[model samples]
Target: MSVVNPLVRAEALEARAYQLRIAEEAIKRNTLVVLPTALGKTVIAALVAAHFLYNYRDLKVLVMAPTRPLVLQHRDTFLRLLKLRPDDVQVLTGKYDPEYRLQAWQGKSRIYFATPQVVNNDHSLGMSLKDFSLLIFDECHRARKNYAYTRVAQAYISEAPYPMILGLTASPGADREKIEEISKALYIEHIEARTEEDEDVSPYVNPVAVEWKLVRLPESHRAVERTIRRMLDDRLQRLSAMGVIRKNPKYIFRSDLLEAGEALRVRLEQTPSPEERGPLFAALVLQSSALTLYHALELLESQGPQTLKLFLERIKSSGKAGHRAIVSELVFNGVYRVLESSDLEDHPKVEALEKLVLEQLSSNPSSRIIVFTQYRDTSAYLAARLSKLGVTVVRFVGQADRGQDLGLTQDQQSLLLDRFRSGDIKVLVATSIGEEGLDIPSVDLVVFYEPVPSEIRYIQRKGRTGRRSFGRVVILATEGTLDVNYLVASRRMAERMKKMVKELNSELHPIIRLGPAPEKKPIPADWIARAELPPSSPETAATTFEAELESVEKERRAKFNRELRETARRVLNSVLTAGKNGLPFEELCTELEEEGRNPVAIRSAVERLRAEGQLMKKEGRLFPAGVEAEIPGARRHVFEVLRVQLGEAILRVDDSFNAILLSADYNGPRELLRRGNRFSAISEIYENDKARHVRIYAVEELSD
Candidate 1:
């Protein structure tokens, strides 16, 4: 094992003395380290890993993280800091060949950075974890029951001769139960919780004061919120009675509880004049979906014809009578009844978001910002509105493949991040996908279009900002709805976290203050000009030519209607039988099920083939469908869920609109289908989660 220079490795030692000291002490004993976001928790992991690596030359160091991205990050960091060669460090993720990974595992690689799932699967497959000297759990807070972390930790403890485990995270738990649960999962022997107040931490960590601002819901909206909350309560009771949800289920049994709230909304629509009913019904729908009344009002006002159009389309495609019924009630009996009577242009939150964007832009013209919203339709709505204000805006999303539309992709996410990093784009309007370990470009601000309930979400959102220096965060809340409740909940969570950290600290603490409300500014009428660049340059021409050639080849192949193509279903089944680790078997089965194919049959065929040795499995639970040398171009069709909006918009299907365009030159129906083609959209409707807009039409679907 290659060891990094003692002097160079020690440089990180001085940065966070308290964290390092705690980590060093903990290495001698099993430890749980809880630090807040941006607290350099990764640094502590590295320091401990380094200590183990240098001290125990006979055993390897294993770091188990929660996600592939986290694994990659840890692996890359260790390689850079410890000056280890790539080959010397093994990163086992769901993307690797399991057999290959096991072979490598049997070797002398000193450091193994992997997702817990990989470790668990390998151990299940008879691979041993006994050789590793140390086990580091990143995001140790997540090591609860049934998670892969639990299995891996148990196996390591059982098998390893020297069981040295280090648990790391920013937030271990909001309350004591969660913290204790985490400790038990990692078999933690000691707890080291540090705060910004500690003498050693004071210079490196800054205290942040959390402020809660309540935006009262208009009386009209407050009544609506109560009615829906009551409705959700009733449905929860029904679900519990049915055994679909047991008592104290982690979350509600049904995923679409908000949709159930529409029953109360129908009652509200019955009593209103066109003017009073239309807007009220719209507000009711948004509130029922867990959106703040403030946010709903903003959407009702600012997002025009297209917004309502998307809503109607989603219901129609879903084949869900309830959606249609609620929308009908809203329009005929409630808000839409008043659409002709009231002006949506004068809505307040629309004006507030607009003002917030402009003020931030003008003040920090050079600072990039990311605005997050709950719905794809809403994100598009905000992006369009912001673009009109002259700021360059990109909407980032995760692509959904099972439906007619595709979601944003990893590539689009990466491209936008790159653009933001290079100052090419000024603002990014994204969804929850932007909240995690994505290389989100440093931003000057984070604007929450609506507040979310998860404590993890709250930290991830806030953590996006204030990374380099003091950054601004804006939460847009609509008055008199769940928006107020959300604001209070988020503030309470942040405050609790702060207090927890302070209580855990070793020194005098100073309270950190949240930023004050700044003056709002209006969006300029002609703020943005179309981006200017020479069209169809050499690179562009080459790409177009290559695409055209590929298109022609696909067309030629489609015309032939080869036997291979006809038997692709059988072939895929055979491939699956031969291998189960690659192509995410469950995901493929789910996709096939969505396509109305018999997943059981498909699964059976794959299982049959696995006994035949035509397919092979890889380390990361990745099952490449065919043999590497014999079928080099064998590809697995992947899909992304783009945006969910009104049903019939053409631009939503445009390649440019997708954020998850990781694949190069995908087969798009738009190429072959004429205008107004009546083909199915890529994915099916969920009727819940707001029917995601698009699906990745299988390459075969394109030909059909």
Candidate 2:
């Protein structure tokens, strides 16, 4: 390790010839650098930034990562490596005020490290990229579609005078098209990619022993798998009957169900006639159910039995009838009720994982290991199961708040990582969040709970280890499950990604330089100020007029309010005067109609009365909020269509009816019903052979 010159610092960091060579070439062009992880990618970025600053003294540099932790990590690295004033390096995140960020960008910062989202937001608010000389995008494979990286890159290309983008990633992707898209999005031309096998990198690379531990499903677990398959088959057959499927249920996949559901929604939107829309909606319901059933079976078969149970519970509580029905069959009053006891032979992968983890601990006691699972439930289950093996375990998931164990806030994740780094935590059982850019400490072992089919994920997970020292990577797979395909696909894709990148570089020449550099201009004082919105549109003008009219109408409503209160009293009197319970909804609307009252006005007054606790609604009739009406079994027609759903025995009201009930049922559904579709006053219109006109409305249509 030696310093190049007095301008750059970090003499402890040995300047690798390969890194310097690539960084030197990449600095001149908008490039995408595909370096294997732990090969000093950040160092190359810092070197490029220092060179840019040295050559273009007036211009600043912006480096972007995907997460705040990574941003902080990169900023720290730059501060240590680049010889500059401490205040010149700034780390911007969402936590920073917009005004504060804009001021910092103006001059307070020379090298800015930030999350892509924050950069996009600030740019949107008038912060110009012209100030920046070099834009380094870390984990740039994510710069696709509407991602903030793509938006920010576009801004840099269009806004900057001499744009140079250095896109960095461990592996861009398996597919040539996607990698090409990333390059195009970032305006990338030259690609400097190096593998561990490359002559320049061979000396610096640490060997990682990757092992595949295969497990076979026991007969007892297969028994559960058989039952789950049968239940799934039944649902699929029902979906086929609904015309949502043309193929056999056995052949239906998640993608197939999703495609059919999407097609149904599109057809429903395009179909002009309401009658035609109904069938599409019904087909969508079946497609949605089939999708749910297929995934549930996948979880049951591949992701251990406990994950399947938790999934079912979550879906059942969600009030989606499709999942609830299958769950009910497995839980209560079904042939395969053995799942009630937890002692059945659990997933074989879980057992195999425990053995490998114990073996790793025995081989190296102080080693830190990360076990990556696809589901939070699986992670939690693995953590619990592994804890019994006398190994320290913790479930590390993302920031999304799902139940309790599923959520790990940013702060929580940081603390856990710190503990794992210092060897306070022996093992980390993590979800997809672990694959993303986070400043994770080098691990002794990286285990894939299940082989992921995606090349990006596969590469990222493997990159976790073999950085600082010799590391071990174990991929656990069920012999006959999707893991087999995923394991094979991952290898195939990793190989393809390299070939594709090499082919792309040979075909597309790097853009040497984009014209002459423009002079640095003074940033306006108002750049930090809030953006002013344009004048109001016609819709807003009409809304304002309507609001003013409503205000004046409220003044006129002084007289109407008195009449409505008096009318409400009369309705109460009628209720008391009439003996049995309260009037039926039909009779009530009829009585109000005879009195020459506006139906909407009458309903508004009734709602006002209900708010004041003067009346309540029961069985579609006004009663009292806390008090039950004297309505008997023969009293007001209660319908009880949705109540049967809660009871779990509603036969005709299957998933199709439940999907309708989702919009027109009760509580959440009842509110949706009240706010009916725009076309008609009918709360919900549905085809039903049991009702007249072969159609039914959630709330019976009010008589004219």
Candidate 3:
């Protein structure tokens, strides 16, 4: 094909022509390309973009990345690959002024890169996707339900004239269901996965070594062990009662784990004595068990090892105030030695990770490494201890608030990653966020802090290394946690992904020899004839049950409405009588019952009123917003109502009943309340209701 785009003529890309041809063919069939990390998934995207751009000169191309930073990166790459002028590509985000963005969209930019949320928001504001011909979804595995990616794709597919779509990802997700969901969301027809076993891709991809590490917990902390076991037993009982879990029973999962930790903390706060410190210290151990158990389950899911020894080691060290005494205490008097010396060393996951880490560390001392753990505290402790031993270690954490329980902001994440890329960081200690697409530069080793319950994570962690160079992955497993379950899931997912890829290839690949397209099986003649018959009595009866449900729901709604209206009337009257001073909870409850609201629904109505801003709560008291105002006509009874008609505005609410005020132009003083309502309006009130369309720049005068 003759090249029309200047960037497509690059000498460096000529070597990729065969891959480009394959991608182009795949695009014609709406394919998915599961290339490994750093395997130039974007290169294939650019090639496909180029082919479509060349043929459909008048149409626009859209590329979407999951994050804003990735969108900018894609736009930059496409700019280089398409040989297009700078003005021909643009990165669109909601951060920009909407008016300016709407103008930019109308301009010459043919390939627009954006985060899905930005596109969805702008589309809501009237940005049309009708002219776009080709849409590309980066990190396509995220195209599953309810994500902005799926909505944007659906919008484009529905609006664009000859819509073609392409999706890219380092790893899709955990399992067949996730993969299938992404496929169905994107309407993908073909999928390509290239593993070491794949003949065509084997030459370019390298295999990595994996090791499993298991550390035995020592025996000195028997009291701590007993406390943990008892707590777990109690919690499991509660879980069983709630029907949440049916476990054979493990050493963790008790409600008292938290209570014990809280009790110990209180004692430490009360008395800094050595006697109290013993039990306090033991409590911390059990607390660590609680945290460790939680993360262990996650690690097991993703990595497949239930017991995470390194995790326990690191956490136990957190309770340590001094050196060898810390290790000695655990080894000599603690339960750590007992667990470590237990027969669990033969545990499969423990054995596997131990082998992986020792083999890799012994052979490759200078290798850059990342150990993925589930708990932040555990990861930090491990990094700190490792660094003290002279291994360069850094904790890569998610952005979470001081007491919040989620990952960090994307910016903090970017900084940590930049440090890793520059080689200033030798080891990356991270959580699951590291598993997806946060690019960490080349590393010779990747250690699973623990096995994760997610197959996608297992694959992503393993895929991290052995990209451009040889690498190794080591999984650290503890003996007893849910680690075994995670490992089993990971293996199953890998097998499923491999089988899916094989099936997809067999169906789509050229050499797979397409016989005549398989014939659509005709409906059996008897079945076709049977379909003409009416529904049976049971089927007809079941259909009637659905209609009965609708009737019942309608009746429930009508009753609900009657109760709400009565409650609203009472709330409105109470506000008027209180005259902006509102009623406390006791008075409001009594008034609600007197006003005919069911005592049972009074509390609920009060909550609903406050939530909808129809009622305001202050100092444990409730005050109504008078009533839901109605639209007035030229001949309406209430002429004093201040009707804002022209521009958007918000009435500032504050602690006290302040003077009526406005920052906008007012033609007249109108009513604040209306006749036949709970509260009556004054004789004259501010009536500047004509200013509601455009946002007012400023309020001109305050009128009462």
Candidate 4:
């Protein structure tokens, strides 16, 4: 049976008893609805939203998610199910300028979909939530702590005259205290929770079969692991000797190291004598080094040798004292030599994954699969490995760019998911970014490259499958490693979460409304009139929305470009005036700040000028591009080799600026041009397309 209501479209939402029951309870009070993924959590929210809209035509609804894509997803869902005009339902994100968002907030939109951060920012800037009758927090597990959800919920509860909250999540958390914190934060008075095994939910859920594939680390890999373990032990022992940490090296956990570091920092802050502060500072460095080593060991044991190699490369390039210490000690102990000379291509789990994926696809050619990993490097490796074996695969990660690893933009991510849905891509190798409220139906198989310790992530990953039909989950783990421990921990925690929710649900007493229930009102005559009015054309409304969005984007870009150009002009002129002596970077920033220029804009302009070759930096000083040529001696700087072209090698400097090194000028081995390799070079700067380009006159490979 389908839900029937004026706001709801005809035969739009198939009525489910559990969802209706949950929504009925939710409408009367602020509630936290905990249901399994692929269930109707969103549907429950939509039904409740439709209820409020029908009964209280004068009030508005605000729905918030953590990400922009999720926000837009909710908007699409609402538009499809509700009879509201497009103009009456609005979506807000960080993409819109503050002024535009302000206007949108003040507009006549009856329902709003937005990300929490944007809403919190707007609230801070005086956007009121007093008119909103219902506030829905999607992924409300994030409400605890200082997350934006908590802040926004506080504001909405305090300001809205008739406040009502609906917090939604598949899994709140395994920790009872954290769940209670979320409840307190969101003002949750009741809980509506269901499981796959629940009477009502069982009939709706397709059974998802879960299997574990365990692999043993090769003996050669263990040798390398032993070396890293030795390094970690040395640091932990030193920390213990200094009284900074009390745990024995063999039994110490990462959390203990973190706590010790914090305690030592506090002790150092209170001490006045430099003599006493010196040992505390040394202990801090040792603690930091121990933490780094701990992480390195985990990566090697869980992710594999290749991922660890990448971590090591990043550490070698880092300027932090802890990072440098780890590199020095590892190199001294021949760990790098062993890793470089080892013939291991990947961890044994990779092979297990390959077998599982091949078997699944072989059995069902039309199946869609998602491979979830904890690290971007592992995602790339798995995607490339599968692609090499003739599988259609793509790496789906978040939008933050690492040193050389670029993430997919929102548009790109949406497109990739569309392709996967349409059977154009068979496998999606994703990081933690894919483990939220993304609605990807018909995913036949979900693979966990490594078992996550967090039960929330474990539940989310398992939920990705078994949506439309029977699904399967394959978790790859290494025997006698953190993989097994994490796997067991997540499972026990998930059980505990279920039990906790059940007890909490039983304990909560429903709140009775202080006044009579508001009478359901008829559809507003103006809304009916607007719905009756014919569109100017078939594409008129969509075109209008697109045009408006485009206009906002153009305005934003224009404003940014104006500020960037003005800042760049002033910064470049000031630097050029200083001549060959160059100006200190901080001095230039102080000068721009005095002029009242935006500090962020000033930084962006300087980076742009440096990239364009209009400006150059050396040893904490800025100079005009090509000023290096005026110096008599060779000026060498280390750079990470990005890639090699026909006659030049592209290199990254200071982990920000990109430069080119011509083959004719470089006198280093060709192998030095390999990506991820580092080299020092004496470079000349030139300008092309008003952007700075670096020309290497001399090069020397930096030893690991």
Top candidate (TM-score): 4
The residue ranges of model 1 lying beyond 4 angstroms of the native Cα positions read 1-14, 206-347, 399-405, 408-412, 437-442, 497-704
Tell me how candidate 3 scores on lDDT.
Answer: 0.57
> Model 1 shows how many backbone clashes?
62
Q: Candidate 3's residue-wise lDDT over 170-194, tens digit each?
A: 5675466777788778767677666
Model 2: residues >4 Å from true position, as ranges? 1-5, 234-251, 328-337, 439-442, 509-515, 518-704
For residue 210, model 4's alpha carbon misses the true position, in angstroms, by 0.9
Instruction: Write down the worst ten-residue block by lDDT for model 3.
Output: 693-702
**TM-score leaderboard ranking:** 4, 2, 1, 3
Pick the winner on lDDT between candidates 1 and 3.
3
Q: Write the per-residue lDDT of candidate 2 for residues 217-267, one digit (tens) a residue.
A: 677677677776776687678777776777787787677777777878878
Q: Least lDDT summed over 10 consecutive residues: which range in candidate 2?
A: 672-681
RMSD of each: 20.1, 20.1, 19.9, 15.0
Candidate 1 structure quality by residue, lDDT tens digits, 552-582: 4354335323422323344444233333234
TM-score of 2: 0.70
Clash count for each candidate, listed in order shown: 62, 1, 78, 5
Of 3 and 4, the candidate ranking higher by lDDT: 4
What TM-score does structure 3 among the candidates reach?
0.56
Candidate 3 at 567: error in angstroms?
Answer: 47
